[model samples]
Target: MNSRAAQLQAFDRLLTIMDELREQCPWDKKQTMQTLRHLTIEETYELGDAILDNDLEEIKKELGDVLLHIVFYAKIGSEAKSFDIADVANEICKKLIHRHPHIYGDVKVKDEADVKRNWENIKLREGKKSVLEGVPKSLPALVKANRIQEKVAGVGFDWEEPHQVFEKLREELAEFQQEVKSNHKERMEAEFGDVLFSMINYARFLDINPENALERTNKKFMERFQYVERKAKDIGKSLQEMTLAEMDVFWEEAKTMDKRF
Candidate 1:
Protein backbone atom coordinates (compact mmCIF):
# COMPACT_ATOMS: atom_id res chain seq x y z
CA MET A 1 0.00 0.00 0.00
CA ASN A 2 1.00 3.62 -0.51
CA SER A 3 1.79 5.70 2.60
CA ARG A 4 -1.61 7.37 2.58
CA ALA A 5 -3.40 4.04 2.27
CA ALA A 6 -1.31 2.63 5.08
CA GLN A 7 -2.18 5.57 7.30
CA LEU A 8 -5.87 5.07 6.54
CA GLN A 9 -5.58 1.41 7.42
CA ALA A 10 -3.89 2.25 10.71
CA PHE A 11 -6.64 4.68 11.56
CA ASP A 12 -9.24 2.08 10.60
CA ARG A 13 -7.60 -0.39 12.94
CA LEU A 14 -7.82 2.16 15.79
CA LEU A 15 -11.49 2.71 14.99
CA THR A 16 -12.18 -0.99 15.02
CA ILE A 17 -10.42 -1.37 18.35
CA MET A 18 -12.33 1.55 19.76
CA ASP A 19 -15.64 0.02 18.74
CA GLU A 20 -14.75 -3.32 20.31
CA LEU A 21 -13.53 -1.71 23.54
CA ARG A 22 -16.60 0.46 23.85
CA GLU A 23 -18.82 -2.57 23.53
CA GLN A 24 -16.79 -5.04 25.60
CA CYS A 25 -14.61 -3.22 28.06
CA PRO A 26 -16.43 -2.15 31.23
CA TRP A 27 -14.28 0.90 31.96
CA ASP A 28 -14.27 2.07 28.36
CA LYS A 29 -17.99 1.44 28.04
CA LYS A 30 -18.66 3.52 31.16
CA GLN A 31 -16.81 6.66 30.08
CA THR A 32 -18.68 9.83 29.09
CA MET A 33 -17.45 13.13 27.66
CA GLN A 34 -17.75 14.84 31.01
CA THR A 35 -15.66 12.12 32.70
CA LEU A 36 -13.02 12.23 29.95
CA ARG A 37 -12.68 16.00 29.64
CA HIS A 38 -10.08 16.38 32.39
CA LEU A 39 -8.19 13.36 31.12
CA THR A 40 -8.04 14.96 27.68
CA ILE A 41 -6.64 18.18 29.16
CA GLU A 42 -4.07 16.21 31.17
CA GLU A 43 -3.04 14.27 28.07
CA THR A 44 -2.61 17.54 26.15
CA TYR A 45 -0.37 18.94 28.90
CA GLU A 46 1.64 15.71 28.92
CA LEU A 47 2.12 16.10 25.16
CA GLY A 48 3.27 19.70 25.77
CA ASP A 49 5.63 18.61 28.53
CA ALA A 50 7.05 15.93 26.27
CA ILE A 51 7.67 18.50 23.54
CA LEU A 52 9.33 20.83 26.07
CA ASP A 53 11.58 18.00 27.25
CA ASN A 54 12.40 17.06 23.63
CA ASP A 55 11.34 13.51 24.32
CA LEU A 56 9.95 12.16 21.05
CA GLU A 57 9.01 8.82 22.61
CA GLU A 58 6.99 10.45 25.36
CA ILE A 59 5.46 12.79 22.80
CA LYS A 60 4.30 9.85 20.71
CA LYS A 61 2.73 8.19 23.76
CA GLU A 62 1.04 11.39 24.83
CA LEU A 63 -0.21 12.00 21.29
CA GLY A 64 -1.77 8.54 21.23
CA ASP A 65 -3.50 9.28 24.52
CA VAL A 66 -4.86 12.55 23.10
CA LEU A 67 -5.97 10.85 19.89
CA LEU A 68 -7.81 8.22 21.89
CA HIS A 69 -9.65 10.99 23.70
CA ILE A 70 -10.67 12.49 20.38
CA VAL A 71 -12.02 9.17 19.16
CA PHE A 72 -13.72 8.59 22.47
CA TYR A 73 -15.47 11.92 22.30
CA ALA A 74 -16.60 11.22 18.76
CA LYS A 75 -17.95 7.85 19.87
CA ILE A 76 -19.97 9.53 22.60
CA GLY A 77 -21.32 12.07 20.15
CA SER A 78 -22.30 9.27 17.78
CA GLU A 79 -24.18 7.59 20.61
CA ALA A 80 -26.05 10.88 21.05
CA LYS A 81 -26.73 11.03 17.26
CA SER A 82 -24.87 14.30 17.08
CA PHE A 83 -21.59 13.44 15.29
CA ASP A 84 -19.00 10.75 14.77
CA ILE A 85 -15.33 10.24 13.93
CA ALA A 86 -15.83 10.74 10.19
CA ASP A 87 -17.75 13.96 10.85
CA VAL A 88 -14.97 15.18 13.13
CA ALA A 89 -12.26 14.38 10.59
CA ASN A 90 -14.13 15.72 7.58
CA GLU A 91 -15.02 18.97 9.36
CA ILE A 92 -11.31 19.65 9.96
CA CYS A 93 -10.47 18.67 6.41
CA LYS A 94 -13.06 21.15 5.19
CA LYS A 95 -11.64 23.82 7.48
CA LEU A 96 -8.09 23.28 6.26
CA ILE A 97 -9.21 23.59 2.64
CA HIS A 98 -11.20 26.71 3.52
CA ARG A 99 -8.31 28.36 5.47
CA HIS A 100 -5.52 27.63 2.97
CA PRO A 101 -6.99 29.47 0.00
CA HIS A 102 -3.46 30.20 -1.30
CA ILE A 103 -2.99 26.49 -1.88
CA TYR A 104 -6.55 25.28 -2.39
CA GLY A 105 -7.70 28.27 -4.44
CA ASP A 106 -6.31 31.26 -6.32
CA VAL A 107 -5.68 33.49 -3.27
CA LYS A 108 -2.11 34.83 -3.30
CA VAL A 109 -0.17 35.32 -0.08
CA LYS A 110 3.17 37.05 0.06
CA ASP A 111 4.58 35.32 3.14
CA GLU A 112 3.73 33.59 6.45
CA ALA A 113 2.31 36.86 7.79
CA ASP A 114 0.01 37.04 4.82
CA VAL A 115 -1.10 33.48 5.44
CA LYS A 116 -1.88 34.34 9.09
CA ARG A 117 -3.76 37.46 8.03
CA ASN A 118 -5.76 35.44 5.53
CA TRP A 119 -6.62 32.95 8.27
CA GLU A 120 -8.04 35.65 10.56
CA ASN A 121 -9.87 37.26 7.63
CA ILE A 122 -11.33 33.90 6.70
CA LYS A 123 -12.53 33.46 10.29
CA LEU A 124 -14.19 36.86 10.12
CA ARG A 125 -15.85 35.88 6.85
CA GLU A 126 -17.04 32.68 8.51
CA GLY A 127 -19.19 34.88 10.82
CA LYS A 128 -17.07 35.12 13.94
CA LYS A 129 -18.14 38.29 15.82
CA SER A 130 -14.61 39.03 16.98
CA VAL A 131 -11.19 37.49 16.37
CA LEU A 132 -10.87 37.08 20.13
CA GLU A 133 -14.09 35.04 20.15
CA GLY A 134 -12.14 32.00 18.98
CA VAL A 135 -9.88 32.14 22.02
CA PRO A 136 -11.06 29.77 24.77
CA LYS A 137 -11.74 31.55 28.06
CA SER A 138 -10.43 28.50 29.94
CA LEU A 139 -6.93 29.03 28.56
CA PRO A 140 -4.24 29.99 31.09
CA ALA A 141 -3.77 33.77 31.34
CA LEU A 142 -0.30 33.85 29.76
CA VAL A 143 -1.35 31.76 26.78
CA LYS A 144 -4.59 33.75 26.48
CA ALA A 145 -2.60 37.00 26.46
CA ASN A 146 -0.33 35.71 23.71
CA ARG A 147 -3.30 34.63 21.59
CA ILE A 148 -5.08 37.98 22.11
CA GLN A 149 -1.94 39.92 21.12
CA GLU A 150 -1.40 37.73 18.04
CA LYS A 151 -5.04 38.07 16.98
CA VAL A 152 -4.90 41.87 17.20
CA ALA A 153 -1.57 41.96 15.41
CA GLY A 154 -3.03 39.84 12.62
CA VAL A 155 -5.45 42.72 11.93
CA GLY A 156 -2.54 45.30 11.98
CA PHE A 157 -2.94 46.54 15.55
CA ASP A 158 0.42 46.40 17.27
CA TRP A 159 3.35 48.50 18.40
CA GLU A 160 5.72 49.25 15.52
CA GLU A 161 8.89 48.94 17.60
CA PRO A 162 10.16 46.79 20.44
CA HIS A 163 11.38 50.05 22.05
CA GLN A 164 7.74 51.12 22.33
CA VAL A 165 7.03 47.86 24.17
CA PHE A 166 10.01 48.53 26.44
CA GLU A 167 8.63 51.99 27.26
CA LYS A 168 5.29 50.44 28.24
CA LEU A 169 7.10 47.87 30.37
CA ARG A 170 9.03 50.59 32.23
CA GLU A 171 5.87 52.56 32.88
CA GLU A 172 4.04 49.50 34.18
CA LEU A 173 6.98 48.63 36.41
CA ALA A 174 7.06 52.18 37.85
CA GLU A 175 3.34 52.03 38.59
CA PHE A 176 3.79 48.70 40.32
CA GLN A 177 6.65 50.13 42.38
CA GLN A 178 4.53 53.09 43.41
CA GLU A 179 1.75 50.76 44.50
CA VAL A 180 4.28 48.73 46.49
CA LYS A 181 5.40 51.92 48.30
CA SER A 182 1.82 52.97 48.96
CA ASN A 183 1.13 49.53 50.52
CA HIS A 184 -2.46 49.48 49.14
CA LYS A 185 -3.10 45.77 48.76
CA GLU A 186 -5.85 45.88 46.08
CA ARG A 187 -4.17 48.55 43.96
CA MET A 188 -0.83 46.78 44.33
CA GLU A 189 -2.40 43.57 43.02
CA ALA A 190 -3.84 45.41 40.02
CA GLU A 191 -0.53 47.13 39.32
CA PHE A 192 1.32 43.84 39.65
CA GLY A 193 -1.03 42.34 37.03
CA ASP A 194 -0.30 45.31 34.75
CA VAL A 195 3.42 44.70 35.17
CA LEU A 196 3.04 41.06 34.20
CA PHE A 197 0.85 41.97 31.21
CA SER A 198 3.42 44.51 30.00
CA MET A 199 6.22 42.01 30.46
CA ILE A 200 4.30 39.41 28.41
CA ASN A 201 3.65 42.02 25.69
CA TYR A 202 7.38 42.94 25.57
CA ALA A 203 8.28 39.27 25.41
CA ARG A 204 5.86 38.96 22.46
CA PHE A 205 7.59 41.94 20.82
CA LEU A 206 10.88 40.02 21.15
CA ASP A 207 9.30 36.84 19.68
CA ILE A 208 9.38 35.03 23.03
CA ASN A 209 6.56 32.78 24.29
CA PRO A 210 6.04 33.96 27.87
CA GLU A 211 4.31 30.72 28.91
CA ASN A 212 7.04 28.48 27.48
CA ALA A 213 9.81 30.66 28.94
CA LEU A 214 8.21 30.62 32.40
CA GLU A 215 7.67 26.84 32.23
CA ARG A 216 11.33 26.32 31.26
CA THR A 217 12.42 28.41 34.24
CA ASN A 218 10.10 26.36 36.46
CA LYS A 219 11.73 23.13 35.24
CA LYS A 220 15.22 24.58 35.76
CA PHE A 221 14.36 25.57 39.30
CA MET A 222 12.96 22.07 39.95
CA GLU A 223 16.16 20.41 38.73
CA ARG A 224 18.44 22.77 40.67
CA PHE A 225 16.32 22.31 43.82
CA GLN A 226 16.59 18.51 43.53
CA TYR A 227 20.34 18.86 43.17
CA VAL A 228 20.50 20.97 46.31
CA GLU A 229 18.33 18.46 48.18
CA ARG A 230 20.65 15.59 47.17
CA LYS A 231 23.71 17.49 48.35
CA ALA A 232 22.03 18.31 51.61
CA LYS A 233 21.20 14.63 52.12
CA ASP A 234 24.80 13.66 51.47
CA ILE A 235 25.91 15.97 54.26
CA GLY A 236 23.22 14.54 56.60
CA LYS A 237 21.51 17.91 56.85
CA SER A 238 17.90 18.80 56.29
CA LEU A 239 17.06 21.96 54.35
CA GLN A 240 15.81 23.47 57.61
CA GLU A 241 19.26 22.97 59.16
CA MET A 242 21.08 24.64 56.24
CA THR A 243 21.77 28.37 56.17
CA LEU A 244 21.06 30.49 53.07
CA ALA A 245 24.86 30.88 52.56
CA GLU A 246 25.39 27.12 52.72
CA MET A 247 22.55 26.45 50.26
CA ASP A 248 24.00 29.06 47.95
CA VAL A 249 27.14 26.90 47.70
CA PHE A 250 25.06 23.97 46.39
CA TRP A 251 22.94 26.30 44.24
CA GLU A 252 26.12 27.61 42.58
CA GLU A 253 27.30 24.05 41.99
CA ALA A 254 23.92 23.19 40.50
CA LYS A 255 24.26 26.17 38.15
CA THR A 256 27.63 24.83 37.01
CA MET A 257 26.09 21.37 36.47
CA ASP A 258 23.19 22.93 34.57
CA LYS A 259 25.67 24.45 32.11
CA ARG A 260 26.99 20.95 31.38
CA PHE A 261 23.47 19.71 30.71
Candidate 2:
Protein backbone atom coordinates (compact mmCIF):
# COMPACT_ATOMS: atom_id res chain seq x y z
CA MET A 1 0.00 0.00 0.00
CA ASN A 2 1.17 3.55 -0.73
CA SER A 3 1.88 6.05 2.04
CA ARG A 4 -0.39 9.09 2.36
CA ALA A 5 2.13 11.33 0.59
CA ALA A 6 2.51 8.82 -2.24
CA GLN A 7 -1.25 8.56 -2.68
CA LEU A 8 -1.62 12.35 -2.91
CA GLN A 9 1.25 12.50 -5.42
CA ALA A 10 -0.44 9.85 -7.57
CA PHE A 11 -3.70 11.80 -7.53
CA ASP A 12 -1.83 14.96 -8.51
CA ARG A 13 -0.32 13.07 -11.42
CA LEU A 14 -3.79 12.07 -12.53
CA LEU A 15 -4.98 15.69 -12.37
CA THR A 16 -1.99 16.81 -14.47
CA ILE A 17 -2.70 14.09 -17.05
CA MET A 18 -6.36 15.13 -17.15
CA ASP A 19 -5.34 18.74 -17.80
CA GLU A 20 -3.08 17.66 -20.66
CA LEU A 21 -5.78 15.42 -22.17
CA ARG A 22 -8.34 18.23 -22.06
CA GLU A 23 -5.88 20.54 -23.83
CA GLN A 24 -4.42 18.22 -26.45
CA CYS A 25 -6.95 15.48 -27.10
CA PRO A 26 -9.67 16.50 -29.56
CA TRP A 27 -12.15 13.92 -28.23
CA ASP A 28 -11.62 15.00 -24.63
CA LYS A 29 -11.92 18.69 -25.53
CA LYS A 30 -15.14 18.04 -27.45
CA GLN A 31 -16.80 16.11 -24.58
CA THR A 32 -19.45 17.60 -22.31
CA MET A 33 -21.02 16.12 -19.17
CA GLN A 34 -24.18 15.31 -21.11
CA THR A 35 -22.20 13.45 -23.77
CA LEU A 36 -20.15 11.56 -21.15
CA ARG A 37 -23.08 10.67 -18.90
CA HIS A 38 -23.95 7.36 -20.54
CA LEU A 39 -20.29 6.35 -20.82
CA THR A 40 -19.84 7.10 -17.09
CA ILE A 41 -22.85 4.91 -16.30
CA GLU A 42 -21.37 2.09 -18.37
CA GLU A 43 -18.06 2.39 -16.51
CA THR A 44 -19.96 2.29 -13.19
CA TYR A 45 -21.69 -0.95 -14.23
CA GLU A 46 -18.33 -2.41 -15.27
CA LEU A 47 -16.97 -1.58 -11.80
CA GLY A 48 -20.05 -3.25 -10.28
CA ASP A 49 -19.40 -6.39 -12.33
CA ALA A 50 -15.75 -6.44 -11.21
CA ILE A 51 -16.78 -6.13 -7.56
CA LEU A 52 -19.39 -8.90 -7.96
CA ASP A 53 -16.80 -11.19 -9.51
CA ASN A 54 -14.33 -10.36 -6.70
CA ASP A 55 -11.62 -9.74 -9.29
CA LEU A 56 -9.19 -7.48 -7.49
CA GLU A 57 -7.09 -6.52 -10.55
CA GLU A 58 -10.22 -5.81 -12.62
CA ILE A 59 -11.67 -3.84 -9.70
CA LYS A 60 -8.53 -1.70 -9.51
CA LYS A 61 -8.71 -0.97 -13.26
CA GLU A 62 -12.42 -0.15 -13.06
CA LEU A 63 -11.83 2.18 -10.12
CA GLY A 64 -9.27 4.04 -12.23
CA ASP A 65 -11.85 4.36 -15.03
CA VAL A 66 -14.39 5.81 -12.59
CA LEU A 67 -11.82 8.16 -11.08
CA LEU A 68 -10.89 9.40 -14.56
CA HIS A 69 -14.54 10.19 -15.25
CA ILE A 70 -14.69 12.21 -12.01
CA VAL A 71 -11.58 14.13 -12.94
CA PHE A 72 -12.92 14.70 -16.46
CA TYR A 73 -16.13 16.18 -15.07
CA ALA A 74 -14.17 18.31 -12.62
CA LYS A 75 -12.00 19.62 -15.47
CA ILE A 76 -15.12 20.59 -17.42
CA GLY A 77 -16.53 22.34 -14.36
CA SER A 78 -13.30 24.29 -13.94
CA GLU A 79 -13.43 25.35 -17.59
CA ALA A 80 -16.98 26.64 -17.03
CA LYS A 81 -15.77 28.56 -13.89
CA SER A 82 -18.39 26.79 -11.78
CA PHE A 83 -16.38 24.49 -9.47
CA ASP A 84 -13.16 22.52 -9.70
CA ILE A 85 -11.96 19.19 -8.29
CA ALA A 86 -11.00 20.72 -4.96
CA ASP A 87 -14.45 22.20 -4.53
CA VAL A 88 -16.09 18.89 -5.37
CA ALA A 89 -13.82 16.95 -2.98
CA ASN A 90 -14.13 19.47 -0.16
CA GLU A 91 -17.93 19.54 -0.42
CA ILE A 92 -18.13 15.76 0.12
CA CYS A 93 -15.61 16.00 2.95
CA LYS A 94 -17.72 18.65 4.65
CA LYS A 95 -20.87 16.63 4.13
CA LEU A 96 -19.23 13.53 5.64
CA ILE A 97 -18.07 15.45 8.70
CA HIS A 98 -21.52 16.96 9.09
CA ARG A 99 -23.27 13.59 8.73
CA HIS A 100 -21.07 11.68 11.18
CA PRO A 101 -21.81 13.81 14.22
CA HIS A 102 -20.98 10.94 16.55
CA ILE A 103 -17.38 11.21 15.34
CA TYR A 104 -17.08 14.95 14.57
CA GLY A 105 -19.24 16.17 17.43
CA ASP A 106 -20.45 14.94 20.83
CA VAL A 107 -23.53 13.18 19.47
CA LYS A 108 -24.06 9.76 21.07
CA VAL A 109 -24.79 6.59 19.13
CA LYS A 110 -25.26 3.18 20.74
CA ASP A 111 -25.01 1.09 17.56
CA GLU A 112 -25.19 1.04 13.76
CA ALA A 113 -28.96 1.48 13.90
CA ASP A 114 -28.61 4.60 16.06
CA VAL A 115 -26.13 6.02 13.60
CA LYS A 116 -28.52 5.36 10.70
CA ARG A 117 -31.43 7.00 12.53
CA ASN A 118 -29.28 10.00 13.38
CA TRP A 119 -28.13 10.31 9.77
CA GLU A 120 -31.72 10.43 8.53
CA ASN A 121 -32.67 12.93 11.22
CA ILE A 122 -29.72 15.13 10.28
CA LYS A 123 -30.79 15.04 6.60
CA LEU A 124 -34.30 16.14 7.60
CA ARG A 125 -32.83 18.89 9.77
CA GLU A 126 -30.72 19.95 6.79
CA GLY A 127 -34.02 20.73 4.93
CA LYS A 128 -34.69 17.45 3.15
CA LYS A 129 -38.46 17.20 2.63
CA SER A 130 -38.42 13.43 3.07
CA VAL A 131 -35.93 10.63 3.65
CA LEU A 132 -36.89 9.15 0.29
CA GLU A 133 -35.51 12.26 -1.42
CA GLY A 134 -32.01 10.80 -1.07
CA VAL A 135 -32.88 7.92 -3.40
CA PRO A 136 -32.13 8.68 -7.06
CA LYS A 137 -34.99 8.63 -9.59
CA SER A 138 -32.74 6.92 -12.18
CA LEU A 139 -31.79 3.92 -10.07
CA PRO A 140 -32.92 0.52 -11.35
CA ALA A 141 -36.25 -0.67 -9.93
CA LEU A 142 -34.84 -3.37 -7.65
CA VAL A 143 -32.14 -1.09 -6.27
CA LYS A 144 -34.62 1.80 -5.95
CA ALA A 145 -37.04 -0.39 -3.99
CA ASN A 146 -34.25 -1.47 -1.60
CA ARG A 147 -33.10 2.13 -1.11
CA ILE A 148 -36.69 3.28 -0.45
CA GLN A 149 -37.14 0.56 2.19
CA GLU A 150 -33.83 1.42 3.85
CA LYS A 151 -34.53 5.15 3.92
CA VAL A 152 -37.98 4.64 5.53
CA ALA A 153 -36.57 2.06 7.94
CA GLY A 154 -33.86 4.49 9.06
CA VAL A 155 -36.62 6.80 10.31
CA GLY A 156 -38.42 4.02 12.33
CA PHE A 157 -41.00 3.18 9.68
CA ASP A 158 -40.37 -0.56 9.63
CA TRP A 159 -41.65 -3.87 10.93
CA GLU A 160 -40.36 -4.80 14.38
CA GLU A 161 -39.37 -8.35 13.60
CA PRO A 162 -38.20 -10.66 10.81
CA HIS A 163 -41.37 -12.72 11.20
CA GLN A 164 -43.47 -9.62 10.54
CA VAL A 165 -41.65 -9.00 7.25
CA PHE A 166 -42.01 -12.68 6.35
CA GLU A 167 -45.74 -12.48 7.03
CA LYS A 168 -46.02 -9.41 4.85
CA LEU A 169 -44.19 -11.21 2.07
CA ARG A 170 -46.58 -14.15 2.38
CA GLU A 171 -49.53 -11.76 2.22
CA GLU A 172 -48.14 -10.14 -0.91
CA LEU A 173 -47.63 -13.57 -2.45
CA ALA A 174 -51.27 -14.49 -1.70
CA GLU A 175 -52.49 -11.27 -3.28
CA PHE A 176 -50.37 -11.95 -6.33
CA GLN A 177 -51.76 -15.45 -6.58
CA GLN A 178 -55.31 -14.07 -6.48
CA GLU A 179 -54.44 -11.62 -9.24
CA VAL A 180 -52.95 -14.47 -11.24
CA LYS A 181 -56.16 -16.47 -10.91
CA SER A 182 -58.25 -13.47 -12.03
CA ASN A 183 -56.00 -13.14 -15.11
CA HIS A 184 -56.16 -9.35 -15.06
CA LYS A 185 -52.89 -8.33 -16.73
CA GLU A 186 -52.60 -4.89 -15.16
CA ARG A 187 -53.65 -6.06 -11.69
CA MET A 188 -51.28 -9.02 -11.91
CA GLU A 189 -48.39 -6.69 -12.81
CA ALA A 190 -49.15 -4.44 -9.84
CA GLU A 191 -49.52 -7.39 -7.46
CA PHE A 192 -46.36 -8.97 -8.81
CA GLY A 193 -44.41 -5.74 -8.14
CA ASP A 194 -45.78 -5.70 -4.59
CA VAL A 195 -44.62 -9.31 -4.14
CA LEU A 196 -41.11 -8.40 -5.30
CA PHE A 197 -40.99 -5.34 -3.03
CA SER A 198 -42.12 -7.43 -0.06
CA MET A 199 -39.56 -10.09 -0.89
CA ILE A 200 -36.80 -7.45 -1.02
CA ASN A 201 -37.89 -6.14 2.40
CA TYR A 202 -37.88 -9.68 3.80
CA ALA A 203 -34.40 -10.15 2.34
CA ARG A 204 -33.29 -6.98 4.13
CA PHE A 205 -34.62 -8.30 7.43
CA LEU A 206 -32.58 -11.44 6.85
CA ASP A 207 -29.41 -9.30 6.38
CA ILE A 208 -29.22 -10.07 2.67
CA ASN A 209 -28.67 -7.79 -0.34
CA PRO A 210 -31.50 -8.83 -2.66
CA GLU A 211 -29.74 -7.36 -5.70
CA ASN A 212 -26.51 -9.26 -5.15
CA ALA A 213 -28.39 -12.50 -4.40
CA LEU A 214 -30.48 -12.18 -7.56
CA GLU A 215 -27.44 -11.29 -9.66
CA ARG A 216 -25.56 -14.31 -8.33
CA THR A 217 -28.48 -16.54 -9.30
CA ASN A 218 -28.53 -14.94 -12.74
CA LYS A 219 -24.80 -15.58 -13.24
CA LYS A 220 -25.18 -19.16 -12.03
CA PHE A 221 -28.04 -19.83 -14.45
CA MET A 222 -26.09 -18.36 -17.36
CA GLU A 223 -23.04 -20.49 -16.58
CA ARG A 224 -25.14 -23.66 -16.32
CA PHE A 225 -27.02 -22.92 -19.52
CA GLN A 226 -23.83 -22.17 -21.38
CA TYR A 227 -22.44 -25.49 -20.20
CA VAL A 228 -25.54 -27.23 -21.53
CA GLU A 229 -25.11 -25.45 -24.87
CA ARG A 230 -21.47 -26.56 -25.09
CA LYS A 231 -22.41 -30.14 -24.26
CA ALA A 232 -25.12 -30.15 -26.92
CA LYS A 233 -22.66 -28.89 -29.53
CA ASP A 234 -20.13 -31.56 -28.50
CA ILE A 235 -22.83 -34.19 -29.05
CA GLY A 236 -23.46 -32.90 -32.62
CA LYS A 237 -26.80 -31.27 -31.75
CA SER A 238 -28.21 -27.78 -31.39
CA LEU A 239 -30.12 -26.81 -28.26
CA GLN A 240 -33.41 -26.86 -30.21
CA GLU A 241 -32.58 -30.41 -31.39
CA MET A 242 -31.81 -31.66 -27.86
CA THR A 243 -34.48 -33.24 -25.65
CA LEU A 244 -35.29 -31.70 -22.22
CA ALA A 245 -33.79 -34.79 -20.58
CA GLU A 246 -30.62 -34.38 -22.63
CA MET A 247 -30.21 -30.77 -21.55
CA ASP A 248 -31.03 -31.63 -17.94
CA VAL A 249 -28.14 -34.11 -17.99
CA PHE A 250 -25.71 -31.33 -18.96
CA TRP A 251 -27.26 -28.94 -16.44
CA GLU A 252 -26.75 -31.44 -13.64
CA GLU A 253 -23.22 -32.02 -14.88
CA ALA A 254 -22.53 -28.26 -14.73
CA LYS A 255 -23.97 -28.08 -11.19
CA THR A 256 -21.78 -30.92 -9.99
CA MET A 257 -18.70 -29.24 -11.50
CA ASP A 258 -19.17 -26.21 -9.24
CA LYS A 259 -19.87 -26.40 -5.50
CA ARG A 260 -21.26 -22.84 -5.45
CA PHE A 261 -24.58 -24.15 -6.77
Task: Give the TM-scores of the predictions, in the order they appear.
Answer: 0.97, 0.98
> What's the lDDT of the predicted structure labeled candidate 1?
0.93
Q: What is the per-residue lDDT of model 1 for residues 8-53, given as tens digits with 9 covering 90 to 100?
A: 8988999889999999999999999999989999899999999999
Local distance difference test scores for all models: 0.93, 0.96
Q: Mind giving the per-residue lDDT tens digits that candidate 2 earns over 73-183?
A: 999999999999999999999999999999999999999999999999999999999999999999999999999999999999999999999999899999999999999
Question: In candidate 2, how many Å is residue 30 off?
Answer: 0.8
- Model 1 / residue 190 / CA error / Å: 1.2
Number of residue pairs clashing in candidate 2, backbone atoms closer than 3 angstroms, sequence gap of 3 or more or interchain: 0
lDDT of 1 at 63: 91
Which consecutive 10 residues in model 1 have the weakest lDDT in total?
Answer: 1-10
RMSD of each: 1.4, 1.0
**How much does candidate 1 score in TM-score?**
0.97
Runs in model 2 lying further than 4 Å from the true structure: none
Model 1 segments more than 4 A misplaced: none
